[model samples]
Target: MQLFIVGLLGCSLVLSAQALYSSSDDVVELTPSNFNREVLQSDGLWLVEFYAPWCGHCKSLVPEWKKAATALKGVVKVGAVDADQHKSLGGQYDVRGFPTIKVFGANKNKPDDYQGGRTSQAIVDGALNALKALVKDRLSGKTGGSSYKQSGGGGGGGSAQDVVELTDDNFDKLVLGGDDVWMVEFFAPWCGHCKSLEPEWAAAASSVKDQTKGRVKLGAVDATVHQVLASRYGIRGFPTIKIFRKGEEPEDYQGGRSRGDIINAALDLFSDNAPPPELVEILNEESVKKTCEDSQLCVIGVLPHILDTGASGRNAYLDVMRKMADKYKKKMWGWLWAEAGAQMDLEAALGIGGFGYPAMAAINTRKMKYALMRGSFSETGIHEFLRELSVGRGSTATLGGGNMPKISSAEPWDGKDGQLPEEEEYDLSDVDLDEEFRKIEL
Candidate 1:
């Protein structure tokens, strides 16, 4: 009887130990049976971990994984698979080690490996970064069943329209004469590697066009047809990519050939060449209209009066805005500011008066909608606010009047403190203090 009771107790302990997570946790326990239905078919991004119950590293990751799952509840789907028990699923994904984190983005069959830290915050950041890339790919029509035609000179899956065909006739006039930065690929039709690079180049071209606002261009040249231009750049390889800039020697492209790599490199070049967005003061209708209309989203800051915050304080606030503008320059958003009470109509339209000075509102002029910044005015607060908006998680309201507000004309702020109006002295020496008192008494 004693032996039976001990055996039963041991069995219970083993069973409990095998079950690492339960319904109490946010993690969805996955298995081979439901893996396809739950994660493979889902449209949302999934961060799945393949782990073993006996592994020490996997055990440590359990708590952090649960915490990350809770934080990314709605934005991203989090799941776990007991790869030790479900060997079939583990082998399917080639999960040789324990606690392999995979980010299932737009391409479900080929998920990317998560190389971030083991902490919850690191997991969250990685998930958000993956989501952002997915969003960008969708916006560029690279994913969601969109097919790239192989019509252009290259045999890759990119459209001919996107990858510009450069020739000797117009190479110098277009590339060297123009102020825009150029990434030109010299490729031969018979080269196998050049064919593989064509799709990546085409996709990068499409994304770079929108991201850099046409400031950066990607073009391809057939080395065999344009031997003069290719030899000028000393094209020794089959697919040689060169970066061309105004008043500078063409340099070899040292980056990877992947679309993401190309886009990042092009953006780096654009940032080095492009100036920080101009922070304009909203002084008139034209000022507000032009700033808002010129970009995808316009960030408006309603700062305090020059008297309330001296020039130094005001410049500090503007400095924060400038930093944020530089940080998000890739998004190509417009930045504007207005002194409190200087643009009362604009404030009312954006519902900024109730929020107090140093408030912010991001307006999508095309959508006629705006979102207010409820967080602090500091960099961290502003980054959180904008991050939420970028992921389409923040609340927004339609612009008042369904149109741009009537901006009142005002003088630009001078680099000096505001002065109070002088008081006019009045003499009431013979006037009616006693007379009024007597009249009231009567």
Candidate 2:
């Protein structure tokens, strides 16, 4: 939902008090003209739910909002506004997107709101629970015995917001295939360290929001809900935070971290261009194999991407490959020829969408029938990758478990997988990295 100013309307003062019935959890009619008294005078905590009429997510949130309001009476009052219905109101508080549900009174006694989205239940629960926690804090004398003073609200918490919810769909849509640097924490609910480090991740996201702003993104894979994603990424431990630079690929940490620690990690990957997804689909076993095998001059497909791109960058990196191959023909080949990027058909064939950019996939048929160049390579890394693949230069290593530095490559050759298993089929429609979570809902 886009934001537009209400003050420009020239009619500012209107106090139509049509909130939830004292006996019913009906929708509240709060407008920009009346937000002050009805919302500001909330005895305890307030949850102003922002929604848009065209948003499917917002519609789903309606019933859940009513239920949460009903279940959470007395502690915090819940109210909702159709962001589309009241565009002017959205601008007054800087509401800048669709299906956004903001929660006021999240901090102790102070007024705070959250930009919560995704499904209705998650947003409704997060906001109400936050306010409920605030009420408990006030009752427990967290804020100078009054409900307005915050316990930890010293100079620490800003008049800023943190935390976002991403569904698997949007997670890929927005996060996966961009050129921006990204840091993701793979954490589980039962892990004590994961539970403790929540605030650190938030602080880091906030500090970088203004600077990294659109260049960097922070996300979490509730390992409890996304075990397959964790496994695919080789997440072996709790509180593991992984950072992906624009062209340098992704690096991960297995221990816990502080706000400062996470913030520092973010700065390391900052780049003006975010990695795109199209490049990643090219590196799935078959794609990497074909892209490499198709190259005759010890083809070099440098993968300089992190995690993988869903669209353009994959193509962009390939375009870079095409240019390099064409420019340095003498250094590459004719029968010993080299072309770059995913060979379109290969991308569609595997239904995989990463592994070509920020990486180097090479084949040295002279030495072995197939051999990968390496991970995102430095120019020197590129040479090292060729040498290692030269049959006697170094033994080929399996690609599954390694940090793949500037000078490492994954070789499906010389392994016990037994001749590649007839080009295993994969379809994006059937891909559910979080399917395991459905069996055990958190």
Candidate 3:
């Protein structure tokens, strides 16, 4: 009887430890104090999941998602987060819905995964089951390639590669020698969504290699050990992809990705003149001048040519324009600058030629209030005057990024089961606190 009791107690302790690891697997906790420095810096595979609690599809998908964790037992880790609770983060990733999946590995940033439709079993089975072709794409080094299992558990009856075990330490050996597109994924083994996307990333890597016959390279990064690299590159969100050239800087890309999209974005690097799109010609001057003359709140930045004087004037203006551009697009600049350009005559009217090189000036169309200042510029710092263009509250860029899905489509973006979730109505009053306060107080 005593022996039996001892055995039972030992079993209970083991079970308890197992339970702790399993529950913690649900999310990757990052705080100022405690962080997973090991997993962040290590050259292993990590998966990131972006989700929201209010999302019905996300709740439903949780059950089958665990199977992915089970499948990649020794190979990877899984991680997740709640976007509704993390709104600041949600905006950074442009997360339009719940349950966004991302993949990562050694010396690599994160990349999008599990984005399209898949059944419960298929989700659990992961890239191997549904995205084997993607896995193959990575292997062939083309952004678009085929898939075959080279081993490490997600086979689900697919062929496996018993040779060359790709561990965290050896992850580089898989890519360094290859000419193919290297799809190095950085992930944690504890993240479920990461696990789910692993097979897809792997299959995509392998398939791409085989198809392209070694034109591309697919690599992996365990971000746990490489936090410095991740942070330096602004990997505020998981599953980021930094496509590296043979001797150039890697650009950051993630979320809402597809095979064709990844290839197209990266392939241009091989071509000449691949920099971020630049706007050359300023808009037609006279039309803009009249509009600026007529309109209120003309925001102006010093022209780039005025740089010899210094950047304070232009940079302050650029900073404000960058913030405004988040929602208003390029046309706003044409309208805004024209109005500011007209104000130069007013500055001349005031005999203010000795004004600072970099200055921020705003004029009310109706009030014609002249408010110009010289100082350091920040995107968020000048929120007050520009925001006045909106009635009392600011418009959210999060709310305006997409159009409604077509009704004729079978799998539409309905914010429902198959479709992506719609944004919950932000409390108009809450967003506009003064209005609510005024109503109550008066």
- Against the reference, the lDDT scores of all candidates come to 0.84, 0.50, 0.43
Give the per-residue lDDT of model 3 (tens digit) for 1-442: 9999999999997656322124545434332121134333334455556676667677665655555656654655555556666554443334666767665442222345555443544544554443454455557874321222223432112223111223444444443433434444555555554554444454444434443333444544446555655555565544555565444555554532433333333333222222222221123444334545534344554333332423454444554565554433312222233112334543343223545434444544444344443334455434454554433232222111132111111121122122245788765654778887899999
lDDT of 1 by residue, 125-165 (tens): 99999999999998998764321222443322234335666
Give TM per candidate.
0.61, 0.28, 0.30
Shift of residue 58 alpha carbon in model 2, Å: 51
For residue 182, model 2's alpha carbon misses the true position, in angstroms, by: 0.7
Question: CA shift at 268, candidate 3, in angstroms?
Answer: 32
Candidate with the larger lDDT of 1 and 3: 1
Model 1 spans with C-alpha error above 4 angstroms:
1-160, 427-442
Better of 1 and 2 by TM-score: 1
Best by lDDT: 1
Report the Cα lDDT for residue 348, model 3: 46
Error of 3 at 175 (Å): 34
Model 2 C-alpha lDDT per residue in residues 232-321, reported as the tens digit of each score:
678788878776654565676543364555655555545324222122233244444443343343453533322244235444555655
- Candidate 1 global TM-score: 0.61
Off by over 4 Å in 3: 1-39, 84-96, 105-107, 129-442
